[model samples]
Target: MLHPDLKAQPSRRLPEHGLAEAVALAAALPDLDVVGQDVVRVAKAVPATLFGSGKVEELAAALRAAEVDLVLVDGPVTPVQQRNLEKQWGVKLLDRTGLILEIFADRARTREGVLQVELAALSYQRTRLVRAWTHLERQRGGLGFVGGPGETQIEADRRAIDEQVVRLRRQLDKVVRTRELHRSARRKVPFPIVALVGYTNAGKSSLFNRLTGADVFAKDMLFATLDPTMRAVELPTGFRVILSDTVGFISELPTQLVAAFRATLEEVLEADLILHVRDIAHSETAEQAADVDDILTRLGVDKSVPMLEVWNKIDLLDPAARKSVEDRGAASEGIFPVSVWNEDGLTPLIEAITRHLDEERQHEDLVIPFADGRARAWLHEEGVVEQERVEEDGVHLAVSWTARQKGRFADI
Candidate 1:
């Protein structure tokens, strides 16, 4: 944990003052709270060894004063840099990527998520095996009593990791199949799915709850909604649909995470439409939007799926700026500015969604025999019967619904 500052100092990836976002993320970890106030920085070229020499000395002094146990670096540090820093500072140190992976490893609850993290960790470890080596390879051949020469620890670790990787891949295949089965089940009923997607901590969960009245753990924290939450919602006029609050997108989202959460993200890929609920007030709103769009591209949803730019948290925006944003979006594609907290500007947003869904709606005028009570009931239960009348020859009905729902009444 070398405290680094690059604000006044300059560097390629991040300057001294440029590391606030990086450090802010590091500080979010509760486990690092003990050293939160003690972390320091050195913004210039990182020494090949410690990445911080003078800064390391200062950090050592500070740790001694603060009685700290660890140093957390906000940027990537090579294995050599980490080991050198530890050896010099006589304290544990961690880099950004390693710290994030550790958090994911600890928080992973599902089988697929755990396996994905383990695979990423194994891959990361394999690259830095330099941290571990042994003298056993220099040993002479084993005695004749032994079956064969013992393998070096490095070779053994590699083989074990490879075995685990293969096992995880097989397990993930089963998980994928299970997800596909659930998808098929949902398709049979065929309620239109709407997915909430946006930057981490962008209030996706809050908007989700506001729209569907579903109580999900909505919090002002990064990755607050890790698991996908689904609820059945009846829009005004009894228009039923399925609403899904899927995992939020973020900048530089770890590849391991994207792969592990594929099952959850499937909601977005398969959604009838995606609501990009963004925090319009954040300073990085534009950048966050770009990041979300980039991830959408990676998910192959950028060009394929219909996306609605939902500028959430409008109350936080200045009135003038908010008006400007809404006005800019007014003439554009699917877009709406709304505040989920105050429930302002939601009617139009919901209407916009219904309009998008209109394309999926099928209308038909059909007549069922007067004696066919079952067909009449089917039409009422499955399709939205816009009009119904009774005549001596048959029961006449005008219906609008999805093709799947229409199929349910094909017998009529």
Candidate 2:
């Protein structure tokens, strides 16, 4: 792995740390074994190879010494640079975007997720058509009858890609429409949605499993969970809610993914509550938090939706540091410190979610006709019917429900 620290484009993370992240990203792929890594300091990127010739030579020797089969570049590499680097290093080359695409392709399990990853991968590959097909230089003479010139290999490949992209988009649109219908259906179920979101590998999935009794793939790896998972969970106050576990955010997330996976992230937009889980023990926890917040802003999550910061993985911290974190959380309004592994401080987190949901509750009296048994049953099913009395005109009911439940009841 090579993390090129270009002078013009500075990163929020240290060069060494960035290289470490790239290694971790490579490790996420099961088929690849990471043998060597480095941070290459560059005054400016070489247009052809990204690294200077001397740096390239040095890396080539290192690669040979390490017996590395592939070189992962932790930054964007133009098509020209990618081709040149692979030739000079005599190894397969993958840039950050390509590495991420591979990981997404491996992790996506659902139909929608698989489609999204394919679309994003095609989009990324579309730009590198020159490097993808070596026959771009070959030309074919046109037959006199049909066209002026026969299509080149590059043109044919690009046309094929364009057609595939169109087909995938059409399929993805249908899938997204179906998902929206599902969302509409969930809206009528009278359960508030609480979504868990945070930086990748921040234990969002672990916490989700602990809270919802779900067996979602949870591991200490980046992007352990890709497709969103939802489960019904009851808060301490007897308030039942739908908890959604979504793909985690990361610093410098690929633009292709952000656009392609927007459909999956709609759950976060519709959430009644957002839980921003964090790995409090990580060295760059604050920076990771900022990255997550930035992505949320980019996603246009409603500012009105209540968010609670979960300081997870306290088990990794020392006792004094853990106490400090707990005290800080207590002093704050929307922060909670907990360790999902230890099952510590989860009750308060649940209570906080219940409080946020209950804050929108309103009490109202409604008159229902004797024949409207469905509406009455809905109110009872939602556990919001506080009192009811039968009258000559109709049945009088007093109910306490959140605004969302009231809207659903209104529909009934």
Candidate 3:
């Protein structure tokens, strides 16, 4: 893996840290055996190779010495640059976007997850198909208006990609509709959704397992949990909520991926509460948090939805740092510093979650018509009906419910 540190560009992370992240990204793919890594310095990005010829040759020699089968570039590389680099280095080359697509493709398990990864990969592949058909850029015999330049090889490849994209989107839309049906059913159940989101390897899965007592795949690797997982749990306050564990965010995530995986992330849009988990022990914790926030914004999450910052992995901190976090968590309103591994500072976090949800509830009076037994039953089923009485025209009831529950009742 190579992380190019361009002199002309400023980065929030140090070059060495960026290189280490690249290595971690490569590690996410089980088939990859990362034998070598480096932070390559670049005064200016070469359009054709992204590196000066001399530096490219030097790195090529090193790659050969290490018998590296693949070179993962930890930054954007143009299709031309990728082709040239592969030729010079005598190995397969994947840019940051391509590498991420590989990891997603490898880790995706569900039908929707698999389809989204394939769609993103196809989009990435379509761009690289540009130079592959350069030699066949010629017109073929066809009607002038019908085929334009007679559908060259690149055009054919792109057309095929477009068709595949359309098919994948159709299948994905079916999957999304099914998911929406499930979501609609859940909305009727009166349990609010609390989604867990953070940068990759920030211990979201571990926190999820701790909170729900479900054995989700939790590993100390990037993108370990690719599919969204949700489990309904009754809190200490006896209020129930559906806790969601979603795919982790990363800095400079591919645009293709952001678009393709939007369906998977729609869980966040429906969340009544968001838990922005952070790896406080990471050197780039702040930067990672910023990335997660940016992606959430891009995903069009409603700002009105309540959110709590979960400063996780506190066990990794030193005594002083941990004490500082504990103090900050105590002083702050929406921050909870906890270690899911050690089970420290969790009770307060759970209390805070329940409190936040409960605080949204308001007292409401409703006179249900005798014909609307379903709505009245729903109110009783939700356990929010504090008082009841019988009236002349209908059954009068007093209920305490959240705005969402009130809306659901209205729908009913």
**Cα lDDT, model 2, residue 92:** 90
Prediction 3 TM-score vs. true: 0.87
RMSD of 1: 4.1
Q: All candidates: CA RMSD in angstroms?
A: 4.1, 3.5, 4.5
- Which whole-number lDDT from 0 to 100 does residue 13 have in model 3? 82
lDDT of 2 by residue, 347-406 (tens): 899888888886467889999999989988878877888899999989999988877777
Lowest-sum lDDT 10-residue window in model 3: 132-141
- State the displacement of the C-alpha of residue 383, model 2, in Å, after optimal TM-score superposition: 4.6
| lDDT (CA) per prediction | 0.72, 0.89, 0.89
lDDT of 1 at 382: 54
TM-score for candidate 1, residues paired by index: 0.82
Per-residue lDDT for 266 in model 2?
A: 91
**Clash totals, every prediction:** 16, 0, 0
Residues 1-412 of candidate 1 have per-residue lDDT tens digits of: 3445545553433333225455555654666664444334444556566445666677667777877677777656777787777777777877766766776676566776677677777776765565433442443345444324764555556666778778878887898789789889987767788888898778889988888877888877666666677898776545678888877776666665666667668878889988988888887778789888888888777467788899888788888998988897687767788888899889998888887774467778888887788888876765389999888889889888776666756645
Instruction: Judging by lDDT, tell me the better candidate of 1 and 3.
Output: 3
How close is every model to the real structure, measured as TM-score?
0.82, 0.88, 0.87
lDDT of 3 by residue, 119-210 (tens): 99999989888574356576565566435656776776677788999999999999999999999898666678999999999999999999
Error of 3 at 206 (Å): 1.1
> Can you list the residue pairs that collide in candidate 3?
none
